[model samples]
Target: MLIKKIKRRIYNLFHPIQGELWCLHRVLNEKSVFDENKDLEISPDYLETKIKHYKANNFDFISIDDVYSKRLSEFRYCWQKKFINITFDDGFEDIYNNAYPILKKYNIPFTIYLSTDFVDRKPLIWWLVLERIVLTKENVVLSSGVIYTCPDIISKRSVFKQLCDLIYNEPDNPADTFRRLFSNYVSYFEEKTANTLTWEQILEMCDSGFCTIGSHTVTHPVLTRQQENEVRREIEESKRIIEKKLQQEVLHFSYPYSFWNEQVQDIVLESGYKTAAMGYGGSCRYNKDNVYKLPRVYLVEEST
Candidate 1:
């Protein structure tokens, strides 16, 4: 973490962020109920603090569009004027439920990279599925006679990571591989309670002039894990679907789970995203930077 902060500062020195993008996942409504992944969420109060901090710090809050369009010829060593662009990945409904009002109140311009499948309800998000399966039940047996038990939170977390790696290593259809394992332990899992943002909610935000929705891909698979053709299809299909559904040009793409490579970057450009955000944590002079691999810093409140 310290190393990353150093690198971010170093990168910012050269490609000073006229409009730097900071990424977040969810802003939690209930701390206890949605407590499975605190790493992915922050209280709305904390988010409010962050907004107020930037406001007081003389930072200009700008949109991703502004980064690409307005701020090109302004890199300096003594960078006095800084900008913050907010982005959220995974399309959590909590952003609409909790974060949006605060952001709207502050008049912040932010973008959401929507995982279309999570919103569409075709397949379950595998990580969430794994968390539930491991946490809610103590002794678990797989269909293949593999025995697993998570007697405590630490054990459960470790088990979840193991399952995550197993799923990630699958050569074909990781989602299906996860589904088969999850189905074996189905009774312990409840239906997904924290729903994704609906089209109605998204449209309302779009009309409000504060929200910009971008594609995070259908099924939210790791792009590098799939075949070449499938990778292209994921890129093209997601952009096409969002534009068709939202009636807005989905001009930006964020690689699902911040996973991308040379091939993935090319596919994103070919599919016509004006900019693609990645989470390697740095800022770039966006004048004519590599739009396909725009680096973004993950924003979480510092621990006291």
Candidate 2:
């Protein structure tokens, strides 16, 4: 903790502004890892405890609306006091099923960034595919014309990182690389295996007035891999779909994979969003510049 504080102080020296801090996903139920016996769990009780700590520490719990509100009256209270905003990503069903109740109990507002593809029941995320194939299968053939065979257990992590580096760190068309990776592994999983929030659940949350919806993109493509036209379509099409369904304008976005460059930022602005969240870690202050590329802290179970 002391090291982290020192790091934050060092960062502040260079960056000056404390960007937004957020918790990505707060699951209410116990979820299974590859090994069912080693389940991942996050209970309401645990979250409540964390919230108590946040409040005691004087951190502001903010939502998407709070970030982009033209009227700063409510925010002024936090801004003057130095509170942290809370946000969730990937529009997980648990956000509706579990997290919402806790937020309401505390009257805390939050923003949920949705990936339209998953909301529409697209296949699993690419990383999940890598996990399944690498852990469950002995050999895998990808549509990208690459073949992968699992290494010894001792070397699995390094091997997986190597594969990711080859695909994601390439100078070639990043979109094509991701597409190839997806086509290769997505075929292995059934639709039911993919976790996603239903449209009804989203509407329910909207009506509850405890949460607001924003875009993560239609297909959750890495923006840096795509051309300007493709990037524009991803942003504009996602906002259009969410707006039509919710009967409310969608003005915020979270980039898929948290990958963005200046070109992608231009596309996001052109898409008419008032603000966008990045996976990069930081805090948000009212007077900070670049509202479009707002940084958010990711809360993982390990960290908690």
| Model 2: CA > 4 A from native | 1-19, 26-46, 70-79, 141-153, 171-187
| Tens digit of per-residue lDDT, candidate 1, span 1-304 | 9999999887766666555688888897454222335557788889999899889988888877776666545564435777788899988788899989998999999899988876746346566766666767797667677877789877777777677778777765666787676667665445764678888888888889988988898778889878989898888887888889888788888987677789888888888888899865666663536778787777765444
Which residue pairs in candidate 2 collide? 18-283, 19-282, 19-283, 19-284, 20-283, 20-284, 60-83, 60-84, 62-85
On a 0 to 1 TM-score scale, where does candidate 1 land against the true structure?
0.86
lDDT leader: 1
The TM-score measured for candidate 2 stands at: 0.78
lDDT at position 56, candidate 2: 86
